[model samples]
Target: MTDVAPPVSRPKVVRHQLERLIITGELAPGDRLAEVLLAERLGVSRGPIREAITALERDGLVVQIPNRGAFVRVVSEADARHLYEIRSALFGLACGLSASRHTGSVDIELRGLLSSMRGAAERADHEMYFDLNRAFHRTLLETSGNPFLAKQYETISRSINLFRARALTIPENVAASLEEHERIAAAVTSGDEERARSLGASHIAGGFARHLGESVVAS
Candidate 1:
């Protein structure tokens, strides 16, 4: 009879925690990821911390410098713009498919998210709305019934999330986004594929404007 401890998954756990900090802005862009400090804070050895950092780098959430160690990546404006362009196409397609494929429960869930999102906007709860906003988009993608599209969108979303909170910086912007989401939800739920496609693509475009600067919101 052997009492064997399960295989250690410390690095995977550390990676998820570190990834959340980076996404939620606790570890801001350009923040140094000192392996020793993280190792001590997470109550593990430096080996696991280093392994986690390497994983984050591959996820495009952190960067490793030859001499300076790892840092949370600062997503550039140009890089964000390109990512947005690709997301717009994918999201629009997903919306069309979702409209064609969504079921009753999916419709109810989207409506619920819209309601929560509206309340969050009214209360100026940007963080809450940000989470719900991501949920709303993910629901549409998942309901689209295309696993490949969902997978690609999820991968791109991790990078976009580094700066997504910036999109909700102003109360006015939140209200605008709420309106856009309403239209998107309506289009999807009503089985209007073309409308859903247009609004979905345009929403991501508007999101980029809000993220970078609010000036283009009206455009």
Candidate 2:
């Protein structure tokens, strides 16, 4: 039998790696993403790098300037607020659906994630808490059983990643966020759809307020 090589999607691989770089803070917002540099670093040619960059741009993770080349998108405070508003609505819907469809196993899983997040926060591990926080919300959305809602939330969540970590870095914020998560989990597990929806929206709003406060401090 002739040996057939498995297909390699270089552009997709490059895109994933680039996304990790951005998410992990190795490539911060406003950092220039030079095609040549990325190509060399990823051990891929410029073609694949460019293709991956284009994909990221379409995903709202990168911005291309006419004269300044590509860079990680710098989401402004106003833009973040607007995005959070949309996200708040979507999260509320998803949580409401999840509350309506709650199961013992799903509830247990979410509670476990919240516990882990609390531990991370106690240890002052912002990165670990951030990742767990994402998992907690993602689990809720998936449990919602509404594919369209999940898809829309996923898109907004990705864009929100550009600023989510910054808001959670404050110790007090982390503590308060855990409390909110606890209430959200309680609502979902208890099958309180309205309360789940309200709490979910309020959580996002709180994050938005914290982000705005951070922007003010930075300015």
Candidate 3:
């Protein structure tokens, strides 16, 4: 008897691959995503690629026009500022909630992340640091015990990947960002809700400032 293989969700797989391409700067901002080309590259049918594109569009990672096809979304300065504002508020709330519900295990996990981030920074490994940074924030949000807040935070984070990739490239920014994370962790672990909220908001605001500075230098 021949064994039947489990069905694979091609569209979901394709979407993740596309997302990685964008995050790694392979697709890049403003790059046109041709359906046929993607289908060929990913070894999938164009139908799945089309569906993946639609999903990415809903995620704010791709822009689809009536006749122009799909392109990686180019987040403008205005969009960056707007996203940062929303993220700051959400992060503040998440931190406050986490602080009010802190546990010893949660504190230990956060400290472990901080240690990993320090190691990443010392090696000048921006990519590793970026992953660790994301994990740290996500862990705090999860501690909030509000799935809704975590979902919203994730959506906005995906939309701003371009800005983050550039912002984390600066060595100075890497060090400063780690320090901010340390302060945030300290506030949460110490059960200081107000301080955690303020530090969380300020951390995101600092990233926004750095993004603007980088944009200015680039342009």
- Candidate 3 Cα errors over 4 Å, as ranges: 1-8, 215-219
Alpha-carbon TM-score of each model against the true structure: 0.84, 0.85, 0.88
| 110-208: candidate 2 lDDT, tens digit per residue | 979988998999899988898899899999999999999989988988886766777778888888899999999999999999999999999998878
* Candidate achieving the largest lDDT: 3
Q: Candidate 1 clashing pairs?
A: none
Per-residue CA lDDT of model 1 for 151-191, tens digit only, reads 99988888777877766758878888889999998999899
Report the lDDT tens digits of candidate 3 across residue range 1-219.
999998878788988889878876778888999999998999999998999889999999899988899998888888888899999999999999999999999999999999999999999887889899999999999999899999999999988986686678799898889899999999999999999999999899888888777642222
Question: Per TM-score, what order, best first?
Answer: 3, 2, 1
lDDT of each: 0.85, 0.86, 0.89
Worst lDDT 10-window in candidate 2:
210-219
What ranges in model 1 sit over 4 Å off?
1-13, 40-48, 214-219
Candidate 3, residue 99: lDDT: 100
